[model samples]
Target chain A: MQETIEKVTKVVKKKRAKFPESYIHDIARAAERHDLDDDELDELVRRVKRAYERAKVEKGEAVGTVAAQSVGEPGTQMTMRTFHYAGVAELNVTLGLPRLIEIVDARKKISTPTMAIYFEDEFKNDEEFVRTIANKIGKSNVNDILQDFHVNFAEMNVVAELDETKIKDKRLDFTDIINRVEKAFKKAQIDNNILSFVPSKSNIRELRLLADKVRDLQISGVKNIGKVVIRKEEDEWVIHTEGSNLGAVLKMEGVDKVRTTTNDIHEVEKVLGIEAARNAIIHEAQRTMDEQGLTVDVRHIMLVADMMTADGSVKSIGRHGISGEKASVLARASFEETGKHLLRASIRGEIDHLTGIIENIIIGQPIPLGTGSVGVVMKHK
Target chain B: MKHEMVPDHAVLSKSESNKVLKKMDIHLEQLPKIKSDDPVAKSIGAKEGDILEITRKSSTAGKFITYRLVKD
Candidate 1:
């Protein structure tokens, strides 16, 4: 065993100096277990070196076009349907082509914004604790906890009758609800369990409007979050929320901040900055493609994410974003609104360097890719 | 959450960045870019046009060192 280890180490050191440390260890371990001789180990090292060299990207390769083709071809075969979340019938996630478009476009508001929230150590295994946390995160409007609403037009007042049973079920304090309403409406008065709002004008229309607004007002829980379902995913009880509020969700007591993630890219960007947003885009796109049984390389998705956020902010792939803002005038014109781009370029007296692929392609010249990327000069010796 | 996915980011000094560019035989725009507002970039106080050395753990290779040009 000692002799084999020494032989393997010597062989590894003699081979490619840039060979990864892990690969070296893997070969060394195999050599020890198999007790391979010097000749066999040398052959193995040679084969590994050849494989490594073959795996590297070639110079002058058109990576962008290849990435686009790889992803787009598989995308055409994707089904157009929203998928139901695993074991949850009501929770639907936008999947297939629609989701792919949304991700590339970097839409501010996704069709379905959701969050997968993990619990802290104490609450991870307890279903009861997880349910309580879910209820706390879910939005609670006046309609959810109100027994009745009376718009006293004659008295220029809007009175809300609170349901004690519903409030207790939600684990919300009555005074806290009243305080929130009072803060929302400056002229609000709470006597006992009756909350009254006195409007500035006594018009019936104005009083009715105030009553409507009060009915929809949020009394507790994070705003914008709709239905929250607590389900057992493997051994841990995780909370799946229909709507996403990443900033607020991360601050909750029983929530595991590290494991919680939102589907909205902009929310990730706002709360965690641009790097997290870039990773979110990559992960989301990969997940969407994977659900449809497509196998685009992760590096391709990484390239797209890098391009989208290269300018310090997430931008869509189409007009008003990456394509529209290309440094080359012709490149911008070729993407969209050709006439507008051309007019603007001419007005500004902008010159086209014709160095990029799109511009060269439009002008009937060889694009700057592959063989076209290189320049040659003949010298007589 | 912020620190979990973030790789080790270190801003290269001016001389070192220039050396990298020279060794790679590429212009600043040629290298893959990271945003100036990237959380790792911000934490290290990297400005636009600076180079960031990101060291990531890889399953195939034990460690992989990648560079990104910070862009505004």
Candidate 2:
């Protein structure tokens, strides 16, 4: 079977000069399932060539308008609430329309920031290693590792009883916890595994307040990583985090830095640069549309992503971003705050060049797109 | 630098850049801009004002080609 497939693939490659590489590859793969002779293979290639030609866009096609309609039509049908991310009830993420809006708006701070952390090749399938990394990444407060906090009004101090089992389970050092507590509270005293701190006022209220602070103090793990869920995705163990800290997560050992991604667009930009941010926008918008069972083409999302990141930094789709930054005064005025834009343009003596689509449409001229984009040239002999 | 999200970027030499600009019938300022400090630009040692040919894999077009001028 393998030999036959290879022979068929070779034959397809020989005739792939006219067709696209992807088209040829697809045809070859499809040919593998069927047992076809030379005649049938040649016929299949001929039909694919015709179909490929028909599928291409014409020179004067209005692709931008089509892309806009393709994305916007399905966007109206999306749901509008936070939902559990990928069946992980512990991690709630904003999905559907809200998520799509968040992606296109290029919001700096997302409502539910999450990271999908993959591991290095050796540890990808190792469940034990994944759990350890999750523990190291997930934020843990002092309350999580302590059995109970005893507020002693008589002694004018709060004593925290450490849970040794939990500490060891989290792979945290006892001394590290004590040091953090001492640094936070100048009067903190550490004895063996016990941490006690006396409030300066030395009253019942002060003791209770100090105990509360001690309980809530962060003991270990990376900050902003609220919860970590380890689930096996296909052959490997994948870690899904509630809160994202991409910078810190990428720096950790045994992490596959290339594959690990966060839903936070701005954070991705800050960490990986604009191109990664553009890809993030595409992936996120596509995922959002897919999650809602909407079938908007990827090209539309790609176009939107390209526009947002065209200026080296990610910008929002609406006002204060791409729409507001248009070169034409009439175009900007037409998008939003017509009065403000026109007033500002007039004050600055901005010229309306009528170079773009909206400006041309506003002035009763044919929009400079599709068939209307080109002008006739006359020659006098 | 080897990230899957980032497309393949190659710096165009002075002559090649001039030819590309002439072929496209556009000025250097008309092309999309990439910051000099952009991760991929920095990794590929692209200096300011250099034209980069970016090749991206597209679901629709199979392969899409674009250009960016590195800017400080």
Candidate 3:
């Protein structure tokens, strides 16, 4: 089968000359799947060549506006509210229109940040290991495992009664919690399963406050990760987190670094790179569209992603980003903050060369698009 | 970390870059940019002003090739 695939790829490369590697690979895989004979394979390559040629965009096409319209038209039909994420009632993920807007805007602090965490090959099938990881990832404070925090005025300390059932359920170590408490407070001591801590001020109010503080102390898991849902996706148990901490999650052992991803675009850029961030933008936007049952072409989303990441860093689509950075002063002034942009441009002696479509349209000149983009020079001697 | 989404990025040498610039008819500044501090750029040891060839799997084109100039 491998030999046949290689033979077919070689034939396609020679027959439909200069076909891209991806196209050749696709053709070869299709031939293998269909168990196509030589004649059928030849016809497939020919059709692919014709299709490829037809798919090419003409030079000087106004792709940006077309992409904007394509993506924007379907966006109007999306739901405006958040929804429980895929039967995980605990997680309320922003979807549809709001999510699509969030992605394009490239907001640094995205609402409902989440992560889909995969495990390493060795730990993927291990349910016990996955459950432990989920426990480790979901933030659990002292209050979660403690039955109650009592202020002991007579003893000049606060007593925190531990819930054995909760401890066992969470797979928390009794000694580990004690040690954490000891480290967090100066005079914390443990007896049986109860932890007692002396307040610094040594008063009733101080004791009450200390008990509150102790209850809020994080006993386990990575910070900012709220709730974790361990689900069976296809063959393996995957962890879905309500909050995201990509940098910390990637550092842990048995976590699949490559496959584990966060919905936070800026975080992805900070941890991975601009390229990864661009891919994230495309993935996120496409997902939002798919969830809404909208069918905007992926190329339109890809174009928007490329525009957002064209610079070294990710920028938003609106005034503070790509639109604001346009070479033409008139274009920037035309977008938003008209007075401020025009004033800044005038003070800086910025010139609007009337090169772009917006500036040309503003001055009632022929916009440099399609037939207008072509230039003709005629001279008679 | 070899993230799947990052695709394949290769640094083009001076001669190869010159060919690309000539073919595209654009200056280095006109190309899309990648920061020198970018994780992929740092991993590949790409210095500022160097050109990177990024090959991504496109939804429409099947294969897409883009160039980025590394900048601080």
* DockQ, all models: 0.47, 0.52, 0.70
DockQ of 2: 0.52
Measured on C-alpha atoms, candidate 2 has an lDDT of: 0.83
The C-alpha stretches of model 1 lying farther than 4 A from their native spots are A1-13, A17-39, A82-87, A148-159, A186-189, A197-200, A378-381, B1-3, B29-37, B47-49, B57-63, B70-72
TM-score of 1: 0.85
Superposed Cα deviation of residue A212, candidate 2 (Å): 2.1
Candidate numbers sorted by TM-score from highest down: 3, 2, 1
Residue A152 error for model 1, in Å? 5.5
lDDT of 1 by residue, A1-381 (tens): 555556666776798445776777778888777877788999988888888789877987878888899889999899876665643666878888999999999999899998999988988998877877877888878989888889886788888888899988887877788778878998888887788887777788888888889998987678778988878888999888899998898888988877898889988887776667777888899999888888988878888988997766889998978888889998888888999999999999999999998888788999878789888989989
Candidate 3, residue A132: the lDDT equals: 85
Leading candidate by DockQ: 3
TM-score for the A-chain in each candidate structure: 0.85, 0.89, 0.91
Please report the candidate that would top lDDT against the real structure: 3
Give the least accurate 10-residue stretch of model 2 chain A, judged by summed lDDT: A16-25
Candidate 1: residue A283 lDDT (0-100): 86
User: Poorest 10 consecutive residues of model 3 chain A by lDDT?
Assistant: A82-91
Q: Write model 3 residue lDDT over A310-351, tens digit each, in one string.
A: 998999999889898889988988889999988988899987
Residues A175-265 of candidate 2: C-alpha lDDT, one tens digit per residue = 8878788789888788887878888886788778878898899877787788888888889999999888888888899999889999999
lDDT of each: 0.82, 0.83, 0.88
User: Model 3, stretches more than 4 Å misplaced?
Assistant: A1-17, A26-51, A378-381
